[model samples]
Target: MFVRIVKLSFDPTKIDNFLSNFENQKNSIRNFKGCRLLELYRDKANTNVFFTYSYWDSEQDLENYRNSDLFKGIWANTKIYFNDKPLAWSVDKVVSLL
Candidate 1:
C-alpha cells in the first residue's frame, strides 16, 4: 500500500472556509478509485494546521487521482486558504505492529 500524508497550514481566519471545502469534497476523494482509506487530522497546538492521511493501492493510483478534475477543483479551492506551501509525503510501510 502507498501512504500519503499532506500537511497544510491555513490562514487562521479562513479555517472555516477550508473546513467547508473539505466537507464538500472529502467523500468524493475517499470514494476515488484505488483509494483505500482517508482521514483528516488537526494539530492540537494550532487549529489552523491540518493533515490529511490516505492510503492508496499504488503510486500510479495516487498519481491518477492527482491528475483528475476532482483534485484540481479541490486543490484550487483549498490552496486559496493556505498560509504556507503544503508539504506532502508518499511512503510505504516498513513495519506494522498489528
Candidate 2:
C-alpha cells in the first residue's frame, strides 16, 4: 500500500471552513478508486494545523485521483485558505506495531 500524508496549516479564521470542506468530501475521497483508507488528524496544541492520512493501492492510484477533475475542483477551492504552502509525503510502511 502507498501511504499519503498531507499536513496543512490554515489561516486561523479559515480553519473551520477548511475542516467543514474536508468533512463534506471525506466519503467521496475515500470511495475514489484504489483508495484503501482515509483519516483526518488535528493538532491539539495548534488547532489550525491538521493532517490528512490516506492509504492507496499504489502511487498510480494516487496520481490518478490527483489528475482527476474532482481533485482540481477541491484543491482549487482549498488552496485559497492556506496560511502557508502545505506539506505532503508519499511513503511505504517499514514497520507498524498495530
Candidate 3:
C-alpha cells in the first residue's frame, strides 16, 4: 500500500473556511479510485495546522486522484487559505503493528 501524508498550515482567520471545504470534499476524496483510507489530524499546539493521512493502492492511484477535477477544485479552494506551502510525502510501509 502507499501511504500519503500532507501537512497544511492555514491562515488563522480562514481556518473555518478551510475546514468547511474539507468537510464538503472529504467523502469524494475517500471514495476516489484506489483510495483505501482517509483521515484528518490537527496539531495540538497550532490549531491552524492540520494533516491528512491516507492510504492508496499504488502511486498511480494517488496520481489519478491528483489529476482529477475533484482534486483540482478542492485544491484551488484550499490553497487560498494557506499560511504556508503544504508539505507532503508518499511512502511504502516498512512495518505496521495494526
Best by lDDT: 3
lDDT for predicted candidate 3 compared with the true structure: 0.96
lDDT of 2 by residue, 1-98 (tens): 97999999899999888888888888989999999999999999998888999999999999999999988888987999999899999999778896
Give all TM-scores, in the order shown: 0.95, 0.95, 0.96
Off by over 4 Å in 2: none
Instruction: Please give the lDDT score at residue 86 for candidate 3.
Output: 100
Write down the RMSD of all candidates, one decimal each: 1.0, 0.9, 0.8
Native-to-model Cα distance after best TM-score fit, residue 85 in candidate 1, in Å = 0.9
lDDT by residue for model 3 (2-87), tens: 89999999999999999999999999999999999999999999999999999999999999999999999999999999999999
Q: Candidate 1: worst 10 consecutive residues by lDDT? A: 89-98
The candidate, 2 or 3, that scores higher on TM-score is: 3
lDDT of 2: 0.92
Model 3, C-alpha of 69: deviation from truth (Å): 0.4
Q: In model 3, how large is the Cα lDDT of residue 34? A: 96
Q: Report lDDT (CA) for all predictions.
A: 0.95, 0.92, 0.96
Which portions of model 3 show Cα errors greater than 4 Å?
A: none
User: What TM-score, to 2 decimals, does candidate 3 have?
Assistant: 0.96
